[model samples]
Target: MGFELPDRSVLPRHPVIVGDEPRQSGSGAMFCHLYPANGQPTGEVAGAGAADVDAAVAAARAAQPAWRAMNGDARRDLLLRYAAVLKQHAQELAALETLGNGSPVMMAGYAPMVAAQRFEYYAGWADKLRGQTLSAWNNPAHNYVDYEPYGVVGAVIPWNGPVFAAAMLLAPVLAAGNCVVIKAPELAPYSVMRMGELFLEAGFPPGVVNMLAGGPEVGAAIVGHADVDKVAFIGSGGTARKVLQSAAENLTPCCLELGGKSAVIVFEDADLAQAGQMGLSGAISVSGQGCVNGTRVLVQRSIYDQYLAVMQQIAGHIPVGDPLDPGTVMGPVISEASVQRILGIVGKAREEGARVLTGGQRLDGEYADGFYLPLTIIADVDPASSLSRHEVFGPVLAVTPFDSEEEAIALANGTDYGLGAYIHTRDLRRAHSVANQMQAGMIHVNASGEGMQPFAPFGGMKQSGFGRLGGEQGLLEFLQTRNVWMNLKAPQ
Candidate 1:
């Protein structure tokens, strides 16, 4: 049986758009979207190439002025209207996401809710953008700092959470007064095109929000364009390097949100029930597909055995079934290729000294057609092993035992990545102290994966990628600061 989309009536047509009008790829090619759950054809979109990207950039470059000239209040009003439409059509978007990536329907639905929330959040900031006046700092001169849009922005969004990521990037970028040409990645472009249509329905001006489809060529076109001042890319580490190189050719700035191999530290003093709940939540969230998922588990030796048992039981019980089934907590990975990659990593861990406490294979029989994997935990793991140091991006957790707080911190912060980390403990003072020592862009204290507010900035340090994606920093990413200075007295 074929996987069914919850609602097909709201589906958008194929072909990339340039200034509100749709056009096929230069050679009239199309990219067919397949349901990752069952490998069925769900929809098709225009396979945009360099030609389409160039046209989109040109359109956005042309429309930037008028869009910037519009009052921020007017922009905010329009964005608010779009936010309403997003909430109204959330279910449709959710179904589309599940179809694209095999994300569980329950989790897929949240993408819309989060997207709506982010849009609403950024919309509120539209009119609140401010520049600084520093006349007092500059003697005999009046100095003012103005934040201006970077004109056309090339945003290449990832496939994991297309709607949410796109909305997160788009909302603040638009609020900052930059017109955008969004290049939907290989996995999901249909939902983005649909959102573009929604933006049009909300009365956004043509060319202000453009959509492009295809592969790396399209992305290169957008990022390498002479007129496109900056690019925001979300993807793999290798892919990020390529994007950076492209941006370098144009001397265009970039915001890169890449991969992570985060850690979750559970102290002996932590509430076991609460810690288990939160720990498992991080491990199996989106089947561990999330970038900020706490994949490394460091437990205090005092309660290591007991906590390991709890985790094993938790892993054994998590549901892995159909994405459409509400009872299924975890769904398949995005594609069979992804399933193989995850399994390959697990196999390598097994070949090494790491012992599998539970689950090291794919689910078959009833779930044969889809890419389903049970939660896997590798205990007796070396903190420096590939399994512990690298990102599995699957429902695999690497648990390491630590003797003291110093060892725990060392093991937790061993990896090169510093995206996000979690600490679970009942001692408020200890929690604060440990959290302060944990090196991550975002930290969760006494819990796992809590406190991701739109008002707070989210990004990473070191190789995990730089630049912020939310809050005031997100808006500023699309803007350039200009200093205007005037002499108090006329020059002789």
Candidate 2:
């Protein structure tokens, strides 16, 4: 059965939220958000420009001192209230997400609840931000370190998972006593724009949590704003480099959560069924739009054929249709451009000698108007090809075979990305050894499920960008350290 889309009246009109109120963009520029399901205009939002960004940053700057001055307990209480507000409106937010982004409604529905959980988790850490005491060498003196917020933070989130990303960034930033100016992706701004309203409803001070919806110029202004103090970005690596360049203008430190082409290694003795299921799920979740998805699957030569069979069988059955349908397991890519880009990448991989096992074409019939592509499996992928090196950011799995364990390790770490890695094996010793050798921020041994958690640090090394966005470490990203030294002996 098909699911119905929500009425357009539910969409937000004013996409810029600042100083506790939803306001129209200062530039009066506007853009229409397209539903990925059928490429139809979902709704229109005022596109924020430099003037809006300046106003938002000014608001954040003005609000930071009082926000920082408030005791941790008070901040925690407000954050808890905000989390409850998110939970209360989760259904509305989920519907907006499905309309704006193309994630299955059933799946999009979970993002707000998870976001609330993240807020609750970070709320517990509000009062626990502590410093360290140190001894002065051979002197009658005391020394200690204190952690303090950077004051105002500028955050830019991607479209793939807007609500969750906003929560992931805001929870820790606020918990660390920093006010934030966030630039929500223009492609999917409805849910996050609503989140800004919830902050006011939850009793947060005006301008403490400003939200803007716009394109690259808006992000650049935020990163380059001297008063922003610090920046946290989640997006593609190409965009991250641009953000870095802009941030360098003000010498602002940034926490970049960028893209990845993560690897999953399956050994001979691993449970083939589980490995196939988990590996495919990792590659295809969020319709393969995730930054840390395990899209590269490296298998031992012994079980390589068997693994391919399992993966193909699984891919063939994954339901692909309208995201609003509760029965649909997969939805369209974010836009027609995305569908074309993914197809171009797959076509190039074929030219580079990778064999398409199944689903290398855009879906026709009822799905033709939509940005839809079935789960694609490309076997015999060359490690040196662009398909192996660059991120496709779509539901395309590139499978390669290796001989020795060393070869598997080398293949897994072959790409510039080091965000996440997975190893499936029965041998405990082998799992540990392989996991230790994998050059990624997070490693999963013999298991793969939902991607990131609020309790653990999640980031990447090398070209995948740096800094973290989860757990206590994530809170520290928004804070700076101050050292104090006091003389114990008074001069006579």
TM-scores for all predictions: 0.96, 0.98
In terms of TM-score, the best-performing candidate is 2
Tens digit of lDDT per residue, candidate 2, span 144-201? 9999899989999999999999999999999999999998888888888888878888
lDDT of 1 by residue, 198-294 (tens): 8877888999988877777788788888889889988778889888888899899999998998888989998887777777775688888888888
lDDT of each: 0.83, 0.89
Worst 10 residues of 2 by lDDT: 1-10
* TM-score (C-alpha) between model 2 and the true structure: 0.98
State the displacement of the C-alpha of residue 345, model 1, in Å, after optimal TM-score superposition: 1.0
Error of 2 at 50 (Å): 1.1
Best by lDDT: 2
After superposition, candidate 2 runs with Cα above 4 Å error: 1-4
- What does candidate 1 score on TM? 0.96
